[model samples]
Target: MSADEDRDATAATPPELETDRELVAIVAVADNGVIGKDGDMPWHIPADLEHFKETTMDHPVIMGRVTYEGILETLGEPLPGRTTVVLTSRNLETPEGAVVAHGLADALEAAETAAREHHDGADRVFVAGGATVYEQLLPAVDRLIVTEVHREPEGDTFFPDWDRETWTETARDEREGFTFAEYVRS
Candidate 1:
């Protein structure tokens, strides 16, 4: 299928109005694309953690329901000035210091609106999530900032695979045990 066809098909596959908005997925994965295991990440690198925060701060971080819960438990609070957008089927009783969106399209729309309302131009929106959310948000992303961790851990949850040819590396940094790589869509 063509790009238009792919977008249309993806929009139709899910049962909601498609949102026309840009998004990005920021993640640190292993060489094998393994992200998490047993509902939590298995690695502990201060540099990786700092990179994640530094990249995602001042923007909206879109996530799936489970990812939202995991992030809430893991990160504890919203990153100072950023808005956390949780996409779920359930209508949340409270916002949990974050915004709640109904679906993938809705989540993108929410991010866009939040950016416009808060900032001057279209701001960065990071879909920091589980597999499903990443897959859904991948097509609309402007960049995919991937921190390629050195060791591959056994993971039940993995990052979606993409053609390396489709991305251009913007920056790269290496540490003792891991490497950080940023990819902008080409």
Candidate 2:
């Protein structure tokens, strides 16, 4: 074969399309948009916590370093039954049973890879966040699972402002102290 023919034969094929995976951001925001105060969640609504656990279980979860630390403080370790990817620019040690990524994109990629490897074809990656992580991943999120706390508590962290027109509310469940709402990108 001619040199040109050899080159053509060795050319790489385009990669196959990956399965469509949903990137969902899960957060609990108070009526005044508060998410946290002083590196911890501002409210302790047991129902909201349960809802979060139920929604994110068996899915890959990506979060910022602060959020991961907060979880560690509250729950004693990284969450179980899910792969946790923490995004941080510092040279912090990865939490036990968790993966560390240097940036949001890397964390997300890790989450997707974990979903493929561990979750038996699970299609959702949950972004459980501190404010910075939430803001950084907002543009790419496919769905938002939110717990809207009824009272506005004093808080230092706030959920990023999002355009309501770009998302459609698909489900809502009202509880005693909070309302669980889900929104899909339109």
Candidate 3:
């Protein structure tokens, strides 16, 4: 091809990736929509937790203040090997490593920056939620990595209601009591 043809090809954007950078939400939701009970996951599935860790390994993970606190209770620190961004409307003290955002816009902005600068220029940012955060960020989520638990457990918190038709299932892995599902917007 000619020089002009080469230049044109180089300038053209790839069609496969829908966005320059995607915002991803990762969560485990039971069949009845329960995600948590009193700030903690109602069901303890070690495999699901491992799935969460591997999928979000080097990305920036965003969550609500309460969710961050809940994580602190369990792990005693912000999640390791990833940037932690906490979104809250109130004045709260987080550990040294966590980034705090006062609103959704700030949270998203922080998440993107962290993904680029901190995680070896990652192309995706992750949202780890506590129901409210999930609800607020659903519209902007480009992809979802969900662990769909087969059984319904009692809980006070629930995952947000999302329109399934808007998403196309890209992959699925069936585990013993749960299925790891991935979806991208259609």
| TM-score for each of the candidates | 0.83, 0.87, 0.87
Ranking by lDDT: 3, 2, 1
The alpha-carbon deviation from the true structure for residue 9 of candidate 2, after best TM-score superposition, in angstroms, is 44
Winner by lDDT between candidate 2 and candidate 1: 2
Give lDDT tens digits, candidate 2, residues 1-186: 121332221122112212268778899999999999999987787888788889889889989989898888887888988889988878877655689988655776788788888887788998898888777667677789998899979999998888787789999989888888999877
lDDT of 3 at 78: 93
Clashing pairs counted in every model: 0, 0, 0
Give each prediction's root-mean-square deviation over alpha carbons.
Answer: 4.4, 10.1, 10.1
lDDT winner, 1 or 3? 3
The CA lDDT of each predicted structure is 0.72, 0.79, 0.81
In model 1, the worst 10-residue window by lDDT is: 8-17
lDDT of 1 by residue, 62-157 (tens): 888787777767767655567778888898753544888876666777787877776444557788978877776666666777878889789988
Error of 2 at 84 (Å): 0.8
Ranking by TM-score: 3, 2, 1
Candidate 2: give its CA RMSD in angstroms.
Answer: 10.1
